[model samples]
Target: MKNAAVMHPKDRPEGSEHNECRALGQILDRVGDKWTIMVVGVLSRGPFRFNQLMREIGGVSHRMLTLTLRSLERDGLVSRTAYATIPPKVEYALTDAGRSLIEPLRILSNWAIEFRPVIEKARAEFDSRQV
Candidate 1:
């Protein structure tokens, strides 16, 4: 049998599959983060200032929220609005691109919920075998 690792000349297109996989991995790393998912889900309700976000997303540290917001802002998934005022107010909201992610994340959330029992059983079985 021919080796699976060897790609035929015709398979080498202008945009290689490896590059596409790398790009997908980068995006997944960001969106798949626990804090990112929670932030996106909460922000889907509306824009929120940093303190409000911290309150809404329980258990997230102040530093982690700041980092997550900065990362989301950098990815164009979230927008930061700053207001000129005595206190210099700021809010974070999902961009058009970020809003588009909501449905997919919801679907994934549902799948995880549905599979939790089965996954727990699997884990129990695997752990039992290790003893």
Candidate 2:
């Protein structure tokens, strides 16, 4: 009988590793984007209107915010609600999957805060060498 611990290459689970890496890469690409991270951070504080998100996350343009929210909604990370009125009202909120990203983003924020000085120093050194 073949040893239980030592299976032939063909005996391994089919395409599991490749599929996992591909899926994880796609998720990381989305979450690692700067705009996505910032948008998700603000939305974690509950729903907000378009202008509110713009004010809260300064430096993001109206066009960019619209695109970002639309992408987020398409990805199922956020929900957009529109109210029918003389003046339209819209609000954005995080879905449960989006909420699940908050803790991880917080940890990444802490890491960035702690290492920022080190990174700055490294950047300065690299710049000085670029004569």
Candidate 3:
């Protein structure tokens, strides 16, 4: 993490002796939400209007998407632009800080897809023992 500005404490391996390694829990609290990942992933491609985002990311309600974008914008991970038009035109894009997240998020997404089966099996085994 010497070269990086941000280091997620969750990414650290176990058995570390530094108790203060858990300092960036706020970042995790913000970006670790399920909606944030998907929204950011979509925005990483390019700017999108509100309806476009809702369509691209199916199953997210209008209110939820609005809230997600607002939170991301507040956290400096997303930018919102409104154009002066007849009615109004709005778009959302990733800020520089948000762009920095794309690579790390891509890596994490790959890890999730790759390990899903193994994780599911582990969950089943643990669940069986609980009964």
lDDT of 1 by residue, 10-80 (tens): 56665566776788899999999999999999999999999999999999999999999999999999999
For TM-score, the strongest prediction is 1
lDDT of 3 by residue, 1-131 (tens): 44223455556544442544464676787788889999999999999999999999999999999999999999999999999997899999999999999999899889999999999999999999999
Per-residue alpha-carbon lDDT of candidate 2 for residues 1-131, written as tens digits (9 for 90 to 100): 55423656566467755766798898798888888999999999999999999999999989988988998898899999999986999999999999999999999999999999999999999999997
Q: Is candidate 1 or candidate 3 better by TM-score?
A: 1
Model 3 residue 55 distance off true place after TM-score fit, in angstroms: 0.4
Q: 67 in model 1: Cα distance from truth in Å?
A: 0.9
Off by over 4 Å in 1: 1-10, 13-15
TM values, all candidates = 0.88, 0.79, 0.81
Model 2 scores a C-alpha lDDT of: 0.90
Better model by lDDT, 1 or 3? 1
For all predictions, the C-alpha RMSD in Å is 5.4, 5.0, 5.9
The C-alpha lDDT values of all candidates are: 0.93, 0.90, 0.88
Off by more than 4 A, model 2: 1-20
Residue 12 in candidate 3, Cα distance off native in Å: 20
